[model samples]
Target chain A: MKSAAMSEAAPATTSLPYTDTKPAGHADFYFAINATFRFILRHRGEEALRSCWRDIGGSYYRPVSKQWTEQGMHGVAEYWRAFFKAEPGAEVEVVESADEVRLEVARCPAIHHLRTHGREIVPQFCQHCYFVNEAIASPAGLTARVCGGNGTCTQRFIKRTVEAEAQNLEDIATAS
Target chain B: MIGCYDFCGHYEWTFEWLRQQGGHELVRAYWDEAIHQDSQLHASQLIGEKGIEGMKEYWGPTLADEGAVYERTVTEDVFRIDMHECPSKGFLLRNGLHQYADYCDHCMGWIGPLMQKAGFVIDHEHNHCGQCWWEMRRIDDASPASAPGTLAGTSDVRLRPGWKSPATDHYERATDPDDKT
Candidate 1:
C-alpha cells in the first residue's frame, strides 16, 4: 500500500477536472468551508444542508462523474490521487485494486488546518465526505462508504450493487 | 471531500444553491455571516483594529499565497489594490464553472460589511474579467476615488484596453454589496 504524503512531496501533474496555476490550495480556505457548512446547517437545518452537499456532488462535480463513468475504477483512483495532491497538508494514500479504490487519509487536511488555526469546526464537518462523495459515486455506477474521521478516515469507492452495504452515518465522527 | 483547491468552484456553486433554497437574501446573509464574520475573522479583526495598515497586512500575504497577480498602493488616507488576474475568478474561468450569475459580487458581499465595521468605505469596480480595483478610505474622508492612473500609477487596472465590460459593476463609498451601480 503506497501512500503519498503530500506535504513532503512535489505535486505531480493530476487529472483533476479543474486546474489552477497554483500547485496546491491555500489551507486557510478550510476556514470558509467550515463556515459555509455551519451557516447552511444553522439557517436551513441538517436535512437542507445535506441536500446542498448532495447537489454539490451531483451537479458541481458532474464532470468528474462523467470521467468515472467513462473510465471506471481507474478514473476514481486518478481523481483522488490528484485531488489530495492539490490540498495543502493532506496526508493520504489512494490504494486501487480491481474492485475498488480506498483512500487512507492519515491526516485529514481540513480538520488539521482548522484546529491549527483555532477555528471552531462545525460538528458535522466530517460527514461532508460521505454525503458529497456518495453523490458523486452513485451516478457512475459506484458507491462510497466512509468510516473514522476528525483527522483520520477511510473512504472506499466501490461498484454499486444490491449486495453493497449502505453507509452508516454513525461511522463518521463529529468534529469538535 | 470539498477540497480547497477547487474551493472557488464549489463556493460559486454554493451561491446558487443557497439562492435556490431561500432566494437572494439568503445568499446575501451567507456572505455577511458565513464569509465576513466567520471565515474572514482575521481580516475583520486586523482591519478593525489597525485600519489602513491592517488592510495592507491582511491582503499582502493573502493574495500572494493565493497566487494573485496584482499591485497595491497604500497612502495615509487610502489603501488601493489593482487586481490584474484574480486567482479565484481565474480558477473558475479556467475550469468553465459558472453557477452564480455574478460570481465577482461575493467579494463585496463580505468585504463591504467588514469595511463598514472598520470605519472605512470602499470605492471599487470590477470588469468581471479578472480585472478590478479597490480603494478603501476612512468613512469621513470626503476625497472621491482617484482617477484611474493617479493612485496606482501605471499599475491601475482600469488603464488596460480590455478592462471595460458592459457588465462592469461599480461602487462608490459603498458599505454593502447591494451598493454597486
Candidate 2:
C-alpha cells in the first residue's frame, strides 16, 4: 500500500467528534477492523458479536449520537461527509434533504483495502453499517437503513416518524 | 461503520470490552490469535521468511503510513525501533481515550507471539505517554538490550526527556505481554 503524507489540517466545515493531528487516517487499520469482526464472530456467538457492534455504536460513538440529537439530519450529513473525506480511497456522497441524510458509498475504503490485500472479509461485514448506525441513530430519534453491499451501498438516516420498514438483514449482501 | 480514523479509540475500547466479557485471557487470545495470527499475518510471514530484513520491510512503510515519528537501527544481529512519537498511542492520548490498562502492551501482546514463532525475542519498554523502544534479536542471542544512545545513538528514544515515567513497563528478552519486569 502506498503511504500518503498526512494532511496538516482537517477540512474546515467538518464536525468530527474526535480530533487528530493527521487529516486522513492510515488505511492499514482496515486490517484490524476485518480481523476484529472475524474474532468476535468466532469466539463470541453471532448474537454477542452483534451486541458488541451495538454497544460500540451506542457507547463508543455517543458523541456522534449527541450531535445528531442536537443538530438532527444536518449533523448526520456533515459528519458523514467529513468522515468519508478522511478515509483513504473512499468514494462517497452525502446528500441531505428536509427529513433525511443519504450516504451513497461508491467505494468503501475498508472493503477496498481488505480486498486489495486479499484478506478474507467476514460475510456479515456489511451488516455492521445497519446495526451500528441504527444504534447511533436511535438515541437521536432517527433511524438508519442500508441497502446493497460488498463494495457499495446506500445508507439513509431519517427521522423515526418517516415510518420506514424495519431493515431486512437479507438486503445487505454478504461480503466475500 | 467503525473507521480507521479513530481506530485507536475503538480498538482500545474493544480491549476493555473483551476484558469485561472474558477477562484478561480473552484479551490475550485476541491479540495472539486475531491480531498476531490474523490481522498482522503479513508481519509474521515476512519476519518468518526474512528475519531482521523482514522487520525493516514491514515496519518501514507501516510506521510511515501510521505517521509515527521514530527511528530504526538495523544490524546483522538485531533490529531496533526507537519510538519517539507513537502514532497509535499518541492518538489515544491526544483524544483522551484510555480504555485498556496499558494500551502499550497490545504491541507486545501481538508482536511477542509473532516473534516467538519467528525464533526471536524482544527487549522493550514503554512509558504510558507514547514513547517506547523495541529491540528484537534471535532467541539464541543473549545480548542484553543496549543502553540509551548505544544502538541508535542520539536518535534513541530513551535519551529524550520524559522517556521514563512512573508507569513505564519494561521487558527483557521476553516474548509475552505478561513477561514484563
Candidate 3:
C-alpha cells in the first residue's frame, strides 16, 4: 500500500472527453474503470455499475487509485475487493458527478479520508461538496463510515455550546 | 469470520512464510491463494506468469449484477484472526485452545511451527466455541448442504476432527458494513 503522500505519478488519462451527459451532481454514470472503484456502496444497491471502460478506453487505465496511499481510500478499496470480486478484462460503470464523483459512493472515501485526516489531507480533498447531509436517522442510521482497521470513521458533526455566568470564573487565575 | 490458508490471522504470517520461500510480492498471495489444497495448484509459478492478473482467474463465482458485489477492500492488515469456529449455531468448545496456534490443532497444525520458525507473529483470534457439520456446496447452499461424511467428519475447509465452517468474510475490517445504515 502506498502512503497518502504518494501522488499518482502516472499521468492522468485525458481520454475521457466530457460527454453530452455532463459529469455533474449525482451524475448517472454509464461506465468506470473497475478496480476497487467497481464496488463502492454495492452491498444492497440494485444499481448496475457496469465496467464499460473498454469501449471508452483501455485495460491498463487504472486511475492510480488513491487506495495505494490514503487509509480511507484503502478502506474503500478493501470494501470493494471484499464485496466485488471483479473479473479482469471486465469494464464497468458507476454513478458520479461533473468532477465525476458522488456522495453515496466512492466519494465517501474522499470525504472519509478528509474528515478523519482533517489535520493532514483535508485541505486537499476538502473542496466544497454540496451533498454532505447533516440530518439522517439515529446514530446507527448516520452515514456509515469505517476504516481498514474496522474502526468507525464516519463524519459526526454534532454541535455543542458552553456557557458561564461569570467570564472570570471560567478563566484560571495566575499565581503571581 | 475471517480465514487464512490454515489458521486465522496467519494470513500475514502465511504471507511472510511465503515471502521467505521467495514469493512475498503482493502478487504471490493473490495468485494461487484461493486454490484449495487438493488442487495441487502452484501459486509461485502462476505469479511468474500473471501476477495480479492471475488472481482474478482463481477467485470466486461471478455474480450477474453489481448488486452482488460489495465495495472491494484493497486494504489488508489483519488486526486479529479468530481461532474459534461455531460448532453449531450456539455450541461452545471448552478446551480447544492449543498452546501454539499459528494453525489449527488439526490438519494444518504444522503451519504454526513453520511460521514461527520464519519469525512471524501469531495471535489467537479468541474464538472458543464452534459449530461442526459438513457441506458439499458452500456458497449457493440455502442450508448446510450434506456431504458424504458423518457428523464426526471434517471437510477440507474445516479444522480436523471437526466440521462446521469458516464464515466467508474478509480479513480486513473495511468490510464490516452497516446493513441498516
Q: How accurate locally is residue A79 in candidate 1, as Cα lDDT from 0 to 100?
A: 94
Question: Per-residue lDDT of A65-159 in model 2, one digit per residue for the tens?
Answer: 99999998899998998888789999999999989899999999999999999999999999999999999999999999999999999999988
**What share of the reference contacts is kept in model 2?**
0.55
Per-residue lDDT of model 1, residues B1-181, tens digit only: 9999989999999999999989989999999999999999999999999999999899988988887889999999999999998889988887788989999999999999999999999999998889899999999998999998988888999999879998999999998888877
lDDT of 1 at B100: 95
Task: Locate the minimum summed-lDDT window of 10 residues in model 3 chain A.
Answer: A20-29
Native A-B interface contacts kept, per candidate: 0.68, 0.55, 0.00
* Model 1, runs deviating above 4 Å: A1-13
Against the true two-chain complex, what DockQ does each candidate achieve?
0.44, 0.53, 0.01
lDDT of 3 by residue, A57-96 (tens): 1111121122222323333333233311222221212323
| lDDT tens digits by residue: candidate 2, B1-181 | 8899888899999999999989999999999998999999999999999999999999999998888888889999999998887888988887888778888999999999999999999999999888899999999999999988888999998888778899999999999999989
Model 2: how far residue A111 lies from native, Å = 1.2
Q: What is the alpha-carbon lDDT for the whole of candidate 3? A: 0.21
Superposition TM-score, candidate 3 onto the true structure: 0.17
lDDT of 2 at B80: 95
> Compared with the real two-chain complex, what DockQ does model 3 have?
0.01
In the order shown, what is each candidate's alpha-carbon RMSD? Answer: 4.6, 2.0, 23.4
Candidate with better DockQ, 2 vs 3: 2
Q: At residue B163, give the lDDT of candidate 2.
A: 80
